[model samples]
Target: MNPEAWVALALSLKVAAWATAINLLLGTAMGFALARWRFPGRELLDALLTLPMVLPPTVLGYYLLVLLGKRGWLGGWLHEQLGITLIFSWQGAVVAASVVAFPLVLKSARAAFENVDPQLERAARVLGLSEAAVFMRVSLPMAWRGILAGVLLAFARALGEFGATLMVAGSIPGQTQTLSIAVYEAVQAGQDASANTLVLITSLSCIAVLLSARWLAPQRSAA
Candidate 1:
């Protein structure tokens, strides 16, 4: 592979890592809440969160552009107040990957949390463990493997994020250009060799991640 391809790979890894970290924190909390807390619109919230998984990438990109564009409401405030710009930047790529990959972690984490025995949590509470303590000591530990599987999947998804990242971050070589974007660029420019290299690398990376996730995921007993 060429140096440019290597750089794109590194950048994609960086974006995926950042996205996975964000998803780990946010997805875990939301998953635990949805699994344990009953409230009005709970299902509604889950549906909304899961929408990205099924939505067209271009559509999601449009939404992100609208919400984070220079003249957008939140974007305008952020740019004015914090002097932060997300458009056509690598950070924007991170945000795009995070949004696109979040649902995998959320769904996996929710299922993991749900699989934990509520009775164990009750016992922990009965033992005078605070809610926080119970979660930290019992719930989180029990669900970690499943959550990890989801995290791996999210990382893989983020690594390959294309349309949204391109829309929000554009394809700036060695800046905002990720592996997937590089592939697109290579193909567009008729650089078949570079495109093949990128495609191979991406496929291998995703395959490795999926295998790792499968290995780490909890196995079910025969019914």
Candidate 2:
């Protein structure tokens, strides 16, 4: 309703967009790999990738802080080499959201790839198409709708990411406070009107995204 609320909502959209883009790129690759490959430890790797979906957001945030805090091993290296600091920053929120949203995309993309007919793949290979060509022209086309459904699913998850985003990004108003955080603070401060506005926006955004996902992959809707 106010300028501050507008800023948080805008920031949330920006962060969620970036996070969803990153998830789509990496999740599609990993999901396709897992679906198409057979190797030792594959099951273990899949479980590890999917762990975020089941973990509490606070727990995930704590791990991110441990891994990316200024004095942390990876964080220290990043700061020293690249001058990149994720802690208490919007970039950190993107990372947090991406982590939690990853499994959704991966689950859908993997299922899409798995559902592709093996006969079609063999046919493409026999037609002299390279592996990449077959995937791009055949496999990807066939599975694209499902992959898109997965992408929207991830985007929706990223949009409302709160606990992990708050821990790493610190809810710094215009800088890092997302819609979820805005609603949270509004409630805590007894600004019921503001909280209700934020909640309504969030509810609509989620519904729009989920409906888009369903429309994208009607045949494989996650009923």
Candidate 3:
């Protein structure tokens, strides 16, 4: 394998790993909240959460670029306050992947949280357990299999993310180039061997993620 290929692979792994980690945390929280709480705009929030999944990736990318570009509102504020810039960087790729993968995590986790028996939680509360404690001890453990499935799904989505990542991160080799970007670049440059190699790796990773998710899922009782 070419050294550049290795670099691309490493960077891709870094971005995907970080994206998955952040999404797992945020998605789980959002899923729990959406499942357990009622508030104004809750329905709107749910719709928006799933919107990215339905929207064209290019459109999503364009909007994200506008929102997070250097001169854009949040981007400018972040640049000034934190001295950090997301545009055309690996971090930007991670953000894009996270955005695209979030819905998968949120949907699975929300279903899992909803399926959890509220009676268990109530009993824990009656036993003097705080809400947080009840959630940590009873709810989370009971839903662990589902949460794991969601995390795996999100990780797979992150690994395969392309359009938004390309638009925001710009396929800069050694900086923002990921496996999907590398594959595209290789094909564009007529490097079939490299493209094939990347494709194989990505396909295998996706399969692994899917299989792992299935294996990790809780076995259903035979009816």
Candidate 4:
């Protein structure tokens, strides 16, 4: 294997890890809000949250590119205020992966939050526990297994993200190239050995994550 291949693998892992972490935090918060709150436009938010799951990855990537491009509103503001550029960079890959993987985490976390009995929360409140304390102590622990499963699922999704990432990050070798991008480039260039190796690695990673999620799911049910 070329040193470039190893560099691509490490960068891919780094991007995926950061993307999964951001998705886990944001998705969990969104899920909790959806399950517990009754705010105006809640339905709209829910629909938008699930949009990426339904849309083509290329479409999602295109929209993100526009939204994060230098001339775009948010992108302009970011560049002016923070002097940061997101497009065609490793950080951009992380953002794209997080956007695409968010729905999985949100769905899992919402279901987990809903499964916890409201009565338990009420009892905690009666016992003089603050809302935050009740949630941290009584609710979060009960849903920990589901949250773990959600995080794993998000991690898997992020690892496999290709279209959106490619469009936004541009497959720069040793910089923004990820496992999926590497595989695609190798196949295009008729580098079958490298492509095959990448495919095998990706498949194994996916299988391992799925198995772990399944194992954790049963624990959530038991709890």
Candidate 5:
């Protein structure tokens, strides 16, 4: 591993960590709402949220480019009003990774919240617990393991995000280039040794995260 490899790894970790953190808050809240609240178009909302999981990466990238490009509606406003530019930057990579990895957390959190016994929640409410208190003390505790499993999976997904990141952030060495992009660049440049090292690191990291997720996931008892 060389300095470039280490830089890519560090940048990848930074992007993944930020993306995961954003999803943790958003996914958990959205999942809990989808699980607990019955509303019109709930299924439609879920499908839309999960769209990135099934959409081709290039398509997703195109969508992002359109939305965040310098001339784009949101992007134009952001650049003009806040002096912020997301496209072609590491921050854009974070956004791309977050969109790509969000479904994992959302789906996991929904399942976890749904699996929590409504009776227990009602009982807490009966015992004079506020809705927030009941959620913090009872709901969250029961659903933590499953939620954590989803979080780990999201982290792994974010760490390996390639296409969307590439399109939105581009491959700027030591800046926007992530582990996956690094591997691609290495292979393109015929740096087989570097590519091999990056591939090994990525595989090992993802494998470790997946195993931990499996261990943390809720287990069904024998029927």
Candidate 6:
């Protein structure tokens, strides 16, 4: 691969890593809450969270663009007050990837958390462990492997994100261009070699992530 391809690959990894790192904690919390707690509008929240799973990537991207574009209220306030512009930037790509990938990790974590015995938590509480202590020492350790598998899956999903990324990040080569975007542009420009190179790398990366997930959580493996 050339320097540009290498850059795209690097950026893709960076974006995926950032997205996964953030969502790991956030998604785990969301999953735990959804799985263990019942409150008003819980089902509504679940449906909203799962929207990305069923919605078209472009549709999600469009929503994000509208929500984060300069003219949008949140986006306008962010830019005006905080000077953080999301549209057409790498940050925008990360945001897009994170949103698209969130469902995977969230659903996986929810299932993992559900599989844990509630009695274990009660036992920890009875031992005088604070909620935080129990979570860190008991709950987290027991559920970590399953959670890790979900994170890997989310990373892989983020790595391959295209439509939403393009809508928000606008595929600027060596800047916001990720492997998936690079492949799209290469094919569009009839650069078969470039496209093939990116495809090969992406395929290998996805396979590696999936294998790692299986290794970490073999019991959760589908196949």
Can you give the TM-score per candidate against the true fold?
A: 0.95, 0.95, 0.94, 0.93, 0.94, 0.94
Clashing pairs in 3: none
Q: Which portions of model 6 miss their true places by more than 4 Å?
A: 216-223
lDDT digits (tens) for residues 1-223 of candidate 2:
7898789878989999999999999999999999999999998999999999999999999999999998999998999999999999999999999999999999999999999998999999999999999999999988887789889989999999999999989978889999999999999999999999999999998998888766656665454
Model 1 lDDT tens row, 39-105: 9999999999999999999999999999999899988999999999999999999999999999999
223 Cα displacement, candidate 5 (Å) = 26
TM-score of candidate 4 to 2 decimals? 0.93
Across residues 1-223, which tens digit of lDDT does each residue of candidate 5 receive?
7999889989999999999999999999999999999999999999999999999999999999999998999999999999999999999999999999999999999999999999999999999999999999999888987789788989999999999999999999989999999999999999999999999989988898888666555352111
lDDT of 6 by residue, 1-223 (tens): 7899899999999999999988898899999899889999998998899798789999999999999999999899999999999999999999999999998888888888888888999999999999999878887777776688789989999999999999999989878999999999999999999999999999998999888766766655434
Which candidate has the top score in lDDT? 1
lDDT of 2 at 28: 95
Comparing 2 and 5 on lDDT, the stronger one: 5
Which pairs clash in model 2?
none
Candidate 5: residue 25 lDDT (0-100): 97
Off by over 4 Å in 5: 214-223
Candidate 2 lDDT at 36 equals 95
Residue 184's lDDT in candidate 4? 97
What's the CA error at residue 55 for candidate 5, in Å?
0.4
Worst 10 residues of 5 by lDDT: 214-223
Comparison by lDDT, 3 against 6, better one:
6
Alpha-carbon local distance difference test for all models = 0.94, 0.92, 0.89, 0.89, 0.93, 0.90
Model 5 residue 195 lDDT score: 96
